[model samples]
Target: MRKIWTDGLALLGIALVLGGCATSKEDLLPHDHRTMLDIWNVETSGSAGGGPAARQLLDARQALRRPLTEADVQAAPSVQARYTRTAANEIHRQFHRLPNPDLLMYVFPHLAGSDPVPVPGYTTLFPLYQRVQYALPGERLEDY
Candidate 1:
């Protein structure tokens, strides 16, 4: 009995020690602190590696410094016209309307006024059309 108790206690102690060592360094940090550390590391290390990306960035900066020529100014309007969308086109682009079936509602003819004037019964009823249908996946309206 004595030997069994000692062996059990020894096993428990070994398990506790193993568990302590198994815990990761990241497990000790709070969630928000860990996220902040990750963001900080990315920002600090991102620009450290300089190569073709750096050269491309330098080229872009130089392009920005160059003065605009008369040809560039003349081409601006045509470029703008190609990209610019009208108000109606913009409205159509932003909103996605689903298709709904038309519903025809009939108003029953009834007497009106204190004099009880009889209203003529008519079959005329306006049919309410459903809103515009939206373009879904694989559905093309125009070049997006």
Candidate 2:
């Protein structure tokens, strides 16, 4: 009885799937066909192209607009320049890397491995910290 019920559901599911595929794309869509771009253009057409909502929005924006004074124009660059990341600002200012003092170590001449080989003495610099550290935002990283 269980096997018969399972088989009947499986047959019904297959029939439904086949029935869904029988309807052509043409029948499913509207009689007047339009491309996605055409639909988007119609939907997004602005005040000039003539939508009442768009006209109202444009009028509101125009009402909010104010003419910039000479002082305003002059100060604009200074305000933007403060936050602008240039080579000088990047190296010296806000995003400066935390100071990690390098240790100068002199390695004496030594012999190693199965076959003894003479290694010349040399000075190498290693940072005090294992990894490079960066300053947190608004943290004072200037040398005291």
Candidate 3:
């Protein structure tokens, strides 16, 4: 009985500290893009071609899909999600929509929830938000 009490208390303490690190993922998410980029760096060339380099990029993309960041953490609330699918599948489905071209760079973090999602069949990306063009100096949409 005593051991159970102590263990429970210990678990509670750990949960509080770690949980306090974060709670709400939605707000944490835009910034979570930082974590997403870290994933991209290790996985892909952030390039156009789907040669050996692009797959490597996709690999890097899959690694850091979870939202864990200490840089700006606070006592925010967390989101809990569930799915009928297998655990891994929950994650796969989230980013499954991204085109293969942007898989590693743009898609991973968008998925990687607590729920299981499906991995897309093709290694290539869809047509939406397919290409990312950076803003030129003093350039806005009207400038073009």
lDDT of each: 0.67, 0.79, 0.54
Global local distance difference test of model 3: 0.54
Say what the RMSD of model 3 is: 30.1
The segments of candidate 1 whose C-alpha lies over 4 angstroms from its true place after superposition are: 1-21, 26-49, 77-144
lDDT of 1 by residue, 1-144 (tens): 999999999999999999999998878964554465566444444444555665676688889999999999999997675446777556554344444445656657889899999886665545355345675533554544
Quote each prediction's TM-score: 0.25, 0.41, 0.17
Which portions of model 2 show Cα errors greater than 4 Å?
A: 33-49, 56-72, 85-93, 96-144
Model 3, span 14-131: residue lDDT tens: 9999997877876665554456666565445553334677686567778867576763254333212332355765555432222223333244323345785655443444544656
* Of 1 and 3, the candidate ranking higher by TM-score: 1
Top-down lDDT ranking: 2, 1, 3
Q: How many collisions per candidate?
A: 0, 0, 20
> How far is 94's C-alpha from truth in model 3 (Å)?
81
